[model samples]
Target chain A: MKVTGAVKTGQRPRGIETSKDGKFVYVAVGDDDTIEIIDAATLQVAGKLPSGEDPEQFAIDSGDKYLYVANENSALLTIIDLATRQKVGQVAVGIEPEGVAISPDARIVVCTSETTSMAHFIDVEGRKVVGNLLLGARPRSAAFKADGSELWVTSEVGGGLSIVDPAARKTKQVVKFAIPGLRGEEIQPVGINLTHDGKLGFVHLGPANRVAVVDGISHEVLKYLLVGQRVWHGAFTPDEKYLLVANGASNDISVIDVAAQKVIKSIQVGEMPWGIAIAPTRDR
Target chain B: MRLGIVVLCVAVGWCGVSFGEPSQQLKIGYMWMKPSKIRVSLLDVPADNDGLAGAQLAIDDNATTGQFLNLGFDLVDREVSKGEDPTEAVKELADEGVGMIVTSLDAERLLAVASAAMAHGQLILNAVAIDERLRAEDCRGNVIHVAPSRTMLSDGLTQYLTWKNWKRWLLVVGSHDNDKLFADALRRSAAKFGAKIVDEREFKDTGGARRTDSGIVEVQRQMPLLTQGAPEHDVVVAADESEVFAGYLPFRTFVPRPVVGSAGLVPGTWNAAFDQWGAVQLQNRFVIKFHRPMSTLDMQVWTAVRMVGEASVRTGSADVAKLVDYIKSPEFSVAAFKGQKLTLRDWDMQLRQPILLFDGRNTVSVSPQHGYLHQYSSLDTLGTDRPSSKCKLN
Candidate 1:
């Protein structure tokens, strides 16, 4: 629990993800419209990859062969071949695309557009959109079930979560949250995370300053853990013992005990913290 | 309604199919009359498609969201000439199956259109008329206001000034009828917000071209001289809705003071320089598409059209009555890149939104300034509250 040396990347950095081997980290530089690669070992700038306009969120395949980026301004998903470091194809999507999630098998990718409120499914093999599933308003994040049977998308403005039947390309169910003493419009659902076993789910309620714990199997709300202001994005540690959430407005991170379903600690972070990335524990 | 069927068919045909389901077309009508006004600055001139552009952009945005829901949106724009009866225009759009119309018209024309639309069982969203009567004594159940009433704008500006401790004000009002009405709103705001108007002066409109080579010297000399010897005040509030002398009051005031209201630091629902609360994405998209900055009128029309889209999406249908009821319901709220969700006032069907204080180049601040709280929503602090509102819609 200490501070690491910071590496300046680019302006308005949004989504971040580590490579499968945890060797490199990719950051979507939104304002710069390029994905910057950071060498995890050296904690230094590695290289840059060309992306579409206003790239916010992206997904890397399990094989780490390609990168799929959601370009908010361009309304296109730019596919980059990791090894070649070149954009291979572009698939037109709905407006203001923000979230990207690839299935466990890496055969399918789901891109969620904020304004369009659609979860577009793309075929990795064909490098094209296969189908689209409509959800609530302003869908910001997406996560697939461990078995790839269901895709869960969070609608920030719609204040609900839509669980889609991935194979059939239809919404299986929608889970809405109603907190006591809070208005319905305040219950905005943003980032979502599911346990490795897929038995539990954690949803960061943006501006609501709370995390909803859901029974993964039942897709029902189990409990709510109050967090910081504007709880934007979250990530689980490699061991999956604790969950860390970035509070964009509060400029801090709330650490939750996965087993206890409670907030254990608050860690101060950079101003307006957004996405979070955790690397594998290494021998000191 | 043969025209309505033809337009509806074209809209549905262009949208094609969404995931094998034929798209359900939803058309919103845009009816407006261009305001012919000359301003001191070329930048202040209104674009030919000021409000229409906003509706067009909203249609594009709605269509994007509609794609996933098997819903499609289209805009049918109808422009009326001066002294033209807008009833025919309203009927034409209604005949085309357009159940919702967004208008940027004067009070008279807007009222006429509303009456005509009500006959056809269509709803109207007023995007431009700021006359208080439209939201008060003349309030129509069928006409929902997207534009902030004059009192709302005045209150937004007054709150910011009051928060800044600039409580004393020198009011300069134009003689024109609209300007006088705006002046009344400012007077009401100053009284309600605990600011005292130290003194007031009237600026008569001497008929002449707004722009001329010798005009600047004359205005420069006339403004300060007219403003001279006025009671001491912290700010000079101008009410020149006719685009007469407000812009010239900023730096040309006799006493060194900040100018506000119709010029200088102004209050509006949207501005070209607003980039907060994820508004930059919208501004960027608009600039890329329209090749110009988005104006307050544009944003108003955009909000009006999006309101229709939101209702259609929530109710999952294009039925006019259902959508109207849903919009007027407490359940309906819309996100317009504002920090919080905007809801319509159930009392008068006026959209409640945060007003931006623009200083021409950048957003100076937003109204409902911190600490000005209301029991329900802080936004209600800027406009006609339910208790004070004269609107009686059943």
Candidate 2:
């Protein structure tokens, strides 16, 4: 409540990632080649790390040791040592990368580029490009199960999803469909959410303005749930019982019952609050 | 039949023709839906917060603008779900022979609305959805996007961050897995403009256990340490979509730096508090219509409606296709909050406009302020330009 400034950055920020110990908060300052860190208490800046150009997408290792940033313009993954907060290495891949996910073991990182039609994986320990798996056209964001066994990537242009196997370094499944009352092309699939158990995954379809529930194991789209105008991403509650979709154009968050797969409420945030994440309430 | 054929061709590509001469009822159809039940708490939103506020704004705006042209416009709001069959909803509107429709649904729904409208040879004026895919792979000739794409919004924010010289940042996210996705956008922006992120952290959504008083003190103590050792940072950026505690960042932070991104300076389509350049006047009018503050959804819908009014005043009829073409033309302009004017890109049908960078409380600056120039138009600096766009108009 003390620090007052402008939120004159990013478009619909989705995530609010804090340190493992809940010390610092890292925000993806969309469209800028930088991230903002604030002291959790005073909410002040303690430092800055170097990311690639146009870095909107990012991933952190298991121990929170390494931070991987996907620079959209340079099309490379810039790696920084969390301990030093300095750029240590880089991995070049794809065009206009937007989404980033790290393996459960923190051994690998996956990034999805907007137009590249692929999600590239990097070996976190070696800091090198290790995998490039084919996906639906215009993949924007991806989701990795809590255990890191499987991954789901959404294709905004192709209106589908690509499932990958981190252990096998291959795309295990591809799911596509045409829902009524939507345009085929605009039926772009984006934003994926997986349960902790990795049994159910929710995807926000770009043009469809809805989220599709998929069986994570078989990569089958089980059902569709209405979200909002251009629903882009989903933010899950700590209990995983609720899921909120950031509807880019609707300029609000559509709250859904994950168990029911239906929107129960809609809350107004700032305009296009695309990047969203829910943190466990402090034990206050 | 021959004469009818010629008339149809002329209608398909009508341009610069006087339409106001004829007092016609402007026909329009819209498509929308209710989201699933689960998304409520996740977004920290309420159910009644649907974007209908935008639809109301358009109707009010037209009420003011309609006096000059005598163009009577009426909108029939049709709500549909995933399996509800938009074909019928769209047909009901098209059956009325409404050519142009302003919509605030997802990309697929818009496409369905567009196709259904087009099947009846109608045009769709999309008022919402910012996903780049709508402008890229899913783009259509019959659809004109009236909303600013995410690229535009992000780029607008990025330019200001670079201008502010607060190049270094420390980012914080919430526990939702999607926090990384937003962090991705911030990362991209940082990379493009030669900025840097000191470090990143995740705040777990460990359920609402705030009845006691242990979490805040611990988080307060822990945050400063995590950000330690980063040479220097200019700002603290927090992406708390869940609004867990990042809203409490800034000032409490260990170091003194300007915080931007989500909490500090925020970029959006429209803000209820935005009044600079008399933006409050528009806001007031919108509040009168919906009895609540207007959001980005209302703004986008207001823009689409205002576009119709602008083109109708200039071209004259509800001849939907003709009006659509007028909007798509580079010459078209709309008066939004930004001081100057806004247009549309020919290649991808993206809106060309300036962005208002607000420091949470007030407006700090606007992007593309003469210094930021592009080869095509200054608006090119707002988002992906012709050279960078892969959208091919078929």
Q: Indicate which candidate wins on lDDT.
A: 1
Predicted candidate 1 versus true structure: per-residue lDDT over A1-284, tens digit per residue = 54556778899998888887789999999899899999998988899998878888898887779999998887889999999999998877787888899988888889997766688888888666667777777888999987888889998877889988899988888999978766565688989989888899999998788999999989999998999999988889888888999999999899999999999999887888888888752200
Please write out the lDDT profile of model 1 over residues B1-394, one tens digit for every residue.
6466445534443211224332588889998888775777888788887888889899988877676677788899988988688899998998899999999899999888888887898999999999999989999999999999898899999999999999999999999999999999999998899999999999998885556679878888989987999888999999999888898998899989999998999999999888876688888888988999998999999999999998997788888889988988888888888766788898888888888899999989988887787867788998899999899995
What lDDT would each prediction earn against the true structure?
0.86, 0.67
TM-score of each: 0.91, 0.50
Residue A212 local lDDT, model 2: 87
lDDT of 2 by residue, B1-394 (tens): 5466445534542211212333666755666676444321233242454566676656645543343345667776777767776768778877777667777677767777766776777667777676677788888887778877766766777788788787887887777744554566667767876788878766676775443478567666765764556567888776654455565565667776666655667666776678743365567556665677676666777777667766765566667767877877755666565533466788988777777777656677777543675545566777667877878876
Evaluated on chain B only, candidate 1 has a TM-score of 0.94
Model 2: residues >4 Å from true position, as ranges?
Answer: A1-284, B1-22, B34-50, B81-88, B111-117, B173-181, B203-231, B239-248, B251-256
**Number of clashes in every candidate structure?**
1, 124
Residue A264, candidate 2: alpha-carbon lDDT: 91
Fnat, model 1, is 0.31
